[model samples]
Target: MAQPTAATTTSDGYAEGRTDTETVSRTLATSESGLEVTVFDSIRSISAARWNEVVERSTCGSVFHRYEWLEAIEAGLGKTPRHLVVEKDGNLIGLLPNFVVDIEKTPFRRLSSSYPGFGGPLVTTDVAESLSLLAEAVPELCTGRTVVHQIRGLDTKYMRYNNYLQSEGYEPYRRECRFVLDLTQGYGEIYDGMSKTRRRGIDRGTDGDYEIVEEELTRPNLERFHRVYEQVMDRVDGDGYPLSFFERLLDMRERLLLLTIRIDGEYAGGFLELLDEQRSSIHGFFAAVPEDYFGDHASELLYDYVIRWGIDNGYDTYDFGSTNANFENGVFRFKEGFGGRILPILVWERGCSPLWKMLKAGRSLYWPHRYE
Candidate 1:
């Protein structure tokens, strides 16, 4: 994506050149002293230093809550940010990085702390009080044709705010869960821990004489992954993100990895992993194996390669990403083969009342809607 052309400041919406901070007045949040909450339309407006301070100190913080991540969402995907900031005695205490998402071909718009990733309220102090403030401001952001405000799951490590969110009218549920493997052990131990079936997958894919090569973020490789991604999404009745988003993410190389399995010097399959440096973890964001290569166990090879990479790189855990909560799903079983513990993807959502469900019934629903 090109640099966004500057737009003049406006009363009703955000401006490119000006950073406007809109303050919300609230005297009390459940009898606690008032904490001043404000809004920034563009993350570019805020000091990246100050914003990151909150993330670094906050218990619930992750890379998804960082300024750069939110900025990418705004610039790459064309989502308008409604980043909320919290303060008490002039000290930055909390932040919620939400973007406005419009559901196509429907009358639904919503505010998501993250639409394609994991993030929620990041609070450094007075956790419950800050959460309450964010909770109150969230509904108000869902104005106009907007019908919902969803906070995607926080990383499993810091997803303990269920009660806090539930207190503020956000319902917590799980339709997806991420499989996490401990990567601090030696490769021998890690390999032995895997299910016998998974061991066979590694053997089979290895026998196919494929190589797991780390691919550079070049146009051809990206286009190849994008095509594979689109096919995977199509099979699930889903929509994959545009190539531009991957380009932006690739720029943050310190926190991202792109790897592909090649057979006979040709790309056969690949996967994308997003690194959370602060937490010492790697997340499997995207993976695709063409139908022709399915028998080769490219998916298993990709996971094995990432596991080795994560362990060698000193990452504490390697995530297999989210899968349908159903026990019968192939994806679930595939990830489970790696011998990892299952944990719920902690998500808090509000809105999507009965009317919206009745309105959106069937028709191949995607996320947020699928959860509804």
Candidate 2:
């Protein structure tokens, strides 16, 4: 049964049409802060001024949620996928841009963001209202369809609602952790706060006439990043997602930024970072450096350059991306030297098929490390 809305059935005691074909009117629900909720199908459907206002107010609102970023992802994909927007009193409040992906081409579908990771709902004082609206809207949008809605990299607060989704036959699949760096105090202070020894190493590496520049990822740079990326991937036997995937991303120049790190004319290292300048973040993507030269702390130099570049280019945060166990990886420890903090990410998913749901749940419980 659908949740009760403002409208009621006709006097004849019968609805006009079948639920599948029926046009259901949206009912405004009250937010914890006493705001009303509305949903939009596209960015053009919402007011830009109001949208920016909500982003400014929310902690999770960042450049990644920007229209330009979504457009670029769409352009890279060669088409736009379905988008969902939440508004209050004709003002933008939350946004979700997602596409359906096949798990293994068995007619099962999973919702995905333009990028691999996204925490869609705005970070508001009233997370319950925002989450409740999302939960209610999605099933309505899906209607008769049964599909897995994989909410990627969400803040831990939403985990409380996992049971609510599970009651609707959705399975909670996987959850992971992501690392982020705070860049609000400006780059200089950020650098000053780093561990003394690590800072000394980075300074020593760069003192011998070192320089960094944000270079266009032309054909040459792409090939280089790919080659180095292949080497890094080979170590883990990581399967490459596809070159065309990145090429398509690079094509959307307005929504993307590719920066290469060169040390004294040698290609020391490079990273393809997504920039949301308005939100002041440099999202970490592909990263590569020569393995042999790694001992020289070339990667650290590259990081220093990238963080500075992000700040200079008007970005305030440097997202360090995902990390495994805290002890094994020195990179995580190094990032902490720069005042990086860890953000918990949960992967909540609902399965379309009962068998599929069981299989996914078992795989998640038994073989968590392999999939991740």
Candidate 3:
């Protein structure tokens, strides 16, 4: 639990020379408490087993923090990975899997976590101490660079981390909420606890001829899911990930579950869920339903099936993902019908350069809707 100062080394594993932005290289940083932080430019440099070990042991770890998820993201999104691994006494303790994104036609850059859902560092123990060490090393990681560093904490456990970041001059830019259904109770009890309207929707959907099936995460299945997802996103005017993202997600099919809904042999809706067998938790990653079936309660049916699947599989929790807390949109009301509690998801950010601050201020003025 000692506070450590950071020192950096070059990509060739040397202790001298500066980091080059164009190349994928390694940088080593050490702290005063015998703590060493290594920046790996490639996901392959860290063993999956070792990285997942820290994730499985940490409270904030999720599917997005896994090594395979980052690999797939890099493959699909073409983002540069700048993953940090923290060690103490030659033993692995923490990890922060992040990516570098270059804004098109702009000199500004963003150093953000793998995705917007849930990321930061997965620390086995001494979370605060580990974070302090990581925070100290962040400046070195951003040396000779001008980028905005944004980290999100999805779990309430991250509030402590948020406090630390705030003390270190980071700003809480956005607030989001996520819903989680506890599966430890009986399904009957869970169903009975749902709102009357939600219960009716579930019953109606279940009584219909809609067929629900779990499909393998293959290219064809992913493509079909993406098609439906795109339709829904278009209807809502939401931003969608490229098809290559779903394609890469299929690469880790062993850790993913694809649930598709069919009505009269026609694909109606579907969702992709991430499975954490060790934690007995399932996270709702992405979903899509056509506008034609908006009133048909296709989403309710999907959630019902997913919840029952979790129960059947002996999973302990069903995470419904995040929603903007600033507005109680239709999506938020829809998820609230289920018997899940709302938990805050905080995003901590810091401006690394004058240009980034000016750009951020300009964005606030030009795009006021973003902050709303």
What is the clash count for each candidate, in the order shown?
A: 0, 1, 0
Count clashing pairs, candidate 2: 1
In the order shown, the candidates' Cα RMSDs to the true structure are 4.9, 8.7, 5.9
Q: Where does candidate 1 stray beyond 4 Å?
A: 1-35, 88-91, 103-106, 156-159, 218-220, 352-372
lDDT of 1 by residue, 87-138 (tens): 8887788888888887677766778878778778888888777877878777
The C-alpha local distance difference test score for the whole of candidate 3 amounts to 0.76
Estimate candidate 2's alpha-carbon lDDT, on a 0 to 1 scale.
Answer: 0.58
Kindly report which residue stretches of model 3 are placed more than 4 angstroms away from their true locations once superposed: 1-23, 102-107, 125-129, 143-146, 356-372
Local accuracy of candidate 3 as per-residue lDDT tens digits, 88-202: 8878899988777664346666778756456787888666677777777665555344367778776666776767788877888754678899988968988998999999988
- How well is each residue in 197-266 modelled by candidate 2, as lDDT tens digits? 6688787877665556667767676777777777877876665545555675564455455655556677
Model 1: how far is 363 from its true place, Å? 11
* Candidate 2 residue runs with Cα over 4 Å from true position: 1-60, 71-82, 85-94, 102-109, 113-115, 119-147, 153-174, 186-197, 207-209, 217-227, 239-241, 250-257, 311-314, 329-337, 368-372
